[model samples]
Target chain A: MLEIKNLSARIGDKEILRGVTLSVPDGEIHAIMGPNGAGKSTLSYVLSGRDGYEVTGGEAIYNGQDILALTPEARAAAGIFLAFQYPVELPGVGNANFMRTALNAVKRARGEAELDAVAFLKLARAALKKLSMQDDMLKRNVNVGFSGGEKKRNEVLQMALLQPGLAILDETDSGLDIDALKIVAEGVNALRSETFSALVITHYQRLLDYIVPDKVHVLAAGKIVRSGGPELALELEARGYAGLEAA
Target chain B: MTALPTQRLESWRYTDLRALNAMSFAEAPAASLPDGLPDIGVPRLVFVNGRFDEAASSALPFARNFAAVDEVSDLPLARINAEHAHDGVTLEIPDGVDAGVVLLVSYANGGALHPRHRVSLGAGAALTLLEVVKGDGVYWHNPVTDIVLAQGASLAHYRLQDESQEAFHLATIRATVAADAAYESFTAVMGAKLSRAEFHVELTGAKAHTHLNAAQLLGGSQHGDFTSVVRHKAPDCSSRQTVKSVLCDSARGVFQGRIEVERVAQKTDGYQMSQALLLSPTAEMDIKPELQIYADDVKCSHGATIGALDEEQVFYLRSRGIPEDTARSMLIRAFLTEALEPVTHEGAHALFEAAIETWWARK
Candidate 1:
């Protein structure tokens, strides 16, 4: 389970996340739907411990540990993953090498045996097949010349391989098309288990139709204004985020 | 001998030799060969201090005796090299002969050492020369190499300058390519407290080509300089230069590349790029790219980029569970991929890669 209590953070002088409180239990996927400038991305960045964000007053506890004090890599090793909205382009880093290195690092931190080249390739090939991605995807540099949809799918690919317990997807469906969206959704669905929980942050309700969430919250102006069952997302989509900040 | 060039000269602006001039170096004493020398399974010539070691070298027909260097040049370093250089390689390849590989190893313990090497390839000849320079303690290594390639000849020169942290290495390389000839070279600068490798290449005939690529990995207080001048004097000639530097601690890196196209050198294709990655707040890089084109129809371009590692890229890697140090290394190796792409020789590539790995580990 992941617990975020009174999560107030800022960038420089402007406060972004102001007294935000939310929780996602085990075996559940929650959707955080919000309008523009609602501090959705800031929430994900703060949870992952990215630089430049100052967490003024809050404690993010994941599986009984105060993860707000951990480094980004430490949080990742503690089973926290944040799917970036914009995947970084690594010009000369091969995708296979990157994934293998990341996987081995996580494994090493968890006291698990690190995978060799052969074993890692076998696992990667299997992952690619399941995602319907071609083998050449592994041979190219990491997102060097990838298309918009391809970059999103690559993020899902990383999510599938890493298998984090709590994934915070920050606007991953923005630039993705329908076909790529299904592939990404399937990648998340395949990892559904009792120990797996996800915080899917998106603006449109179309993605929620595929991977239905157990709870939906409206985050407006850095605070959760309304919370309800999965139908809350469809209601907000129909009524629009207008006047919700006043609620 | 001419005096050492000072910072007042435009070409020596970034690299200062006052420290070297202040130190008084005695003649290098004969020292035993160091253990754990790289054996690339080829014909090798070993030089300890400033003297050639015949016992440790393989006997080859083309490996002739060291001849006196009588060539005079305006460069002070070259003039100094010609004056004091006693023993060096004189390799001469016959026409159409493929001299597979030759390894030249230079090891210095201390003091001043200068070795002048000369190589000439006949028409349609091919040769791959790998030179490794290393030393210990404080010393001065100033070597000059002269290469001549006849018509249709090709020479691939690879150098690894792994000197000691307290050593000074200054090398000058001059090459002349005839019609249909190619001179390709790559150097990795991973050692030495202060080092500079200056290259002068001239394409004197039609269709002659050259590629001068290098990578400098410096840490601590080390300073590395790679300066090159490619002169295209004939039509249809081409030259390419890609230099990359990774600086850490208070290290400094410099790249000075100049491309000159003569009036008759129409259709000349020249390109140069210099990039640097500064890993610390104190590390510095200087890049100067110049193009002097007298030809009416020619293509010449140069680019340079110097900056710290991208924080967004670092965060992306760290968010994926890669440790900070490993993430930085991965990005740095990526930065060097383009500069190292031209090193096709398998053994030499591996050796350079190992040297880069060692430099990273020490940093």
Candidate 2:
């Protein structure tokens, strides 16, 4: 569903994602495991269309369209969702209102009818239930004052509501405890379908235990050095990235 | 004499309307509110051109308020004159009267230059005062309000200032809170060619408290300033001030807040914060928040910040299918949301938010 062909990106004068190429087909979960400053987040951002990241070379296509040509919102409407490494805390914007706006924006792009307040609440409640989050979260500001686990779950809650075709989760498990990780992974796992795909960018194999990926890729420096089955994640966990980088 | 520009006057330099002196305003004829306002509230005093109009003023059942002095003939108008004193309204909450009051001040084009209002909250009295200032045409409006809080009195004041693009609006509010009194003021400014508001609060008695919050949203070449001073003069007094502004296009905004704690005001606590968001490259903001503490036992702190819209937040929203413009507008609205939170009246808060949305829409 998503394809990155020799995608290269840079931040100011420094090149990060140097001609990195990868593809994740529908109905499968892919993992990109890399150490810090290894351009793992850079790949996610480049695919999601973040500012200050210049794509010096190559192309990224989603659903047969050049993703680079579309604005971040357009990409999202085209079914691209990026769960930020650190979710923003919008102090006054209610979570429900935010989800409704985003859902409607995507629907509008797809020529679908917008959901009214009643319909939105009904759908949102079901999604929140899947994430095991309380209804109070809807009334509260978007992620404001939420614990790290809560913010991560909020991101998944948004993903569940948006129902995007492809989701790029960048370090969503970083601050999550084991139990919280299970719930988050369960939320993502439940969304897995014949038409849904995801790029799970993480450093630990613990998250892989929850939402097992169909394939694992080792991203070192600016390129993917190796690709293997979910068992590769175990191998990398047993033998740290330091050993693999020198291999 | 030209007003002292001590970061006080020409602070409007970037978007100065002082050149507006060349334009003349025609006086509005005797007029009253046309319709659709509830009359069940407490007493109200309506004035035009710093003069009271008894015939048009409303005196409801629960309404038992009006200056015992009838006219504030001896009130200070040192810097105000007939040349600038166009029209005004005043309301006084009598002793022991604990009710709510609403004052609607509407001005038309060619109206007077200055409209003044004076309000006094009697001891043991509590009141929620809603003041709405609106204008129709391109004119100059200078408004000044003076408030006095007696011992044990409390006031919840909401000031809505929305004028026209062609109008130059300037206003000042000076309030004094006596011992044990409390003052809570929220001012929202969303319109006008050149608008500036000065808020000065004096905590004069032990245990007195003052809270000031302001939100200003300006678009086009509109200009606005929210300058405030909170002085704690008595021991154990407390004060807090927060101001937020959003500017778009070539618009400009300024926030200068100062909190002072006197030496005698031991155990005093003062805090102030000013934040501004520039939505456009040409948009500019000046924020200066200061704290002067003379009491070694007092706690005082002040902070100011001016920044452009958060590009990261914008991208995050856009990546979710919200257009860039919509994302930026949402962030701007969020930036000012904190300052508007203290407004407990849902309807009033909605009206102010609507004003912000309209400003963004017009942009």
Candidate 3:
């Protein structure tokens, strides 16, 4: 389970997340739908401990530990994964090597046996096959020359391989087409289990249609204004987030 | 002893040699052979201090004793080398002969050492020469190498400057390439407290080519400089230079690249790029790229980028569970990929890679 209590953060002087509280229990996926400038991305960055973000107050507890006190890599080892809205490009870093390094790091932190080159390649090839991605995808640099959809798919590929307990998807459906969207959604669906939970942050409701969430929350002015079932997303899509902030 | 050039000179602006001037050095004593020398299963010539060690070397037909000759040059370092140079390698390849790979190993232990090496390749000849310089304790290593490539000849020169952390290494190389010949070289600067490798290459015939690529990995208070002057003296000649520097702690890196195209050297294709990555707040890098084009129709360009590692890239790697140090290393190795791409010799490439890894481990 993940518990975020009154999370307030700021960038420099401007406050972004102001007294935000939310919760996602085990075996559940919650979607946070919000309008522009609603502090959705800031929430994800704060949870992941990115630099330049000052967390004034509040704590995020994941499975019993205050994750807000951990480093980004530490949070990742604690089973928290944030699928970036814009996957960073790493020139000259081969995808296979990157994934293997990341996987081994996480494994080492968890006191698990690290995978060798051959074992890691075998595992990565299996994940690629499941995602319907070509073998050449592993041979290229990490998102160096990838297309918009390919970058998103690469994020999902990472998510599948890492198998985090609480995966945060931050606007991952923005630049993806329908075909790529289904592939990404399937990658998430394949990892659904009793020990898995996800916080899907998106601005659109179309993605919610494929990967239906257990709960929908409207975040505006850095706070959760309304909360409801999956149908609330469809209603918001019809009515738009016009008066949700006032609610 | 010749006076060392000061910072007032244009080429020596970023590098200061006053520390070297303060120390008085004696002649190198005859030292025993150093252990753990790299062996790649090839003919090798080993030099201790400044003299050749024939017992530890393989006898090749083309290898001969070093004989110093009077050569005039305006470069102050080359002049200093010409004054005190003694034993070195002299390799001469005959026409159409593939001389394969040869190793030149120089080990110094506290002294002022100058070794002058000369290499000449006949027409259609090919040779791959790998030079490794290393030492222990405080010393001065000033070596000058002269290379001449005839028509259709090619020479792949790979150098690894792994001097001791308290040593001063100043090397000068001059090469002249004839028509249809190529002079390709790569230098890995991973040691020395203060070091500089200056190269002067001239393409004197049509379609002559040269690639001068290097990578400098410096830490602590070390200083490394890579300066090159490529003169295109004939039409249809080309030159390429890519130098990469990674500085950490209070280390400093410098790259001075100059490309000169003569009036008759039309269709000259010259390109130069210098990039540096400073890993600490105190580390510094200085780059000077000069182009003198007298030809009306030629393609020449130069670019430089010096900056710290990207924070966003760092965050991305960290979020994926990679530790901060490993993440930085991966990014740095990525930055050096382009500069190391030209090292096609398998054994040499492996050796350079191992040296880079050792440098990182030491940090």
Tens-place lDDT per residue, model 1, B1-363, is: 568999999999999999988665446888999888878999999999989999999997898888888866789899888878888899999999999999999999888988999999999999999999988999999999999999999999999999998999999999999999999999999889999999999999999999999999999999999999999999999999999999999999999999999999999999999999998999999999999999999999999999999999999999999999899989999999988877889998999888888888888
Regions of candidate 1 where Cα sits further than 4 Å from its true position: none
Question: Model 1: what is its DockQ?
Answer: 0.89
iRMSD per model?
A: 0.4, 1.0, 0.4
- Categorize the docking of model 3: high
CA shift at B228, candidate 1, in angstroms?
A: 0.5
lDDT by residue for model 2 over B1-363, one digit each (tens)? Answer: 224233334433433544565755445455555453323344545444334556656654433332322223222221532335544555577788886656554544455555656678889888777776665666666666778999999988888787767777777788999999998889988878887787878999999998899888888888888878788899998887778887778888888787888889999988788888877899988877667888899888788888887677788788888888888878888888778766776666776777678777876
User: What digit string (tens of lDDT, one per residue) describes model 1 on residues A189-212?
Assistant: 898899999999999998998888
Q: Give me the runs in candidate 2 sitting further than 4 Å from their true place.
A: A238-247, B1-17, B23-78, B82-87, B290-296
Report, for every candidate in turn, its global Cα lDDT versus the true structure.
Answer: 0.93, 0.79, 0.93
- What is the lDDT for B137 in model 3? 95
Query: TM-scores for chain B, in order?
Result: 0.98, 0.84, 0.98
TM-score of each: 0.98, 0.87, 0.97
CA lDDT, candidate 1, residue A118? 98
Q: What are the per-residue Cα lDDT tens digits for candidate 2 across A44-115? A: 998898888999999998889999998888999999999989998876678888889999999999999999
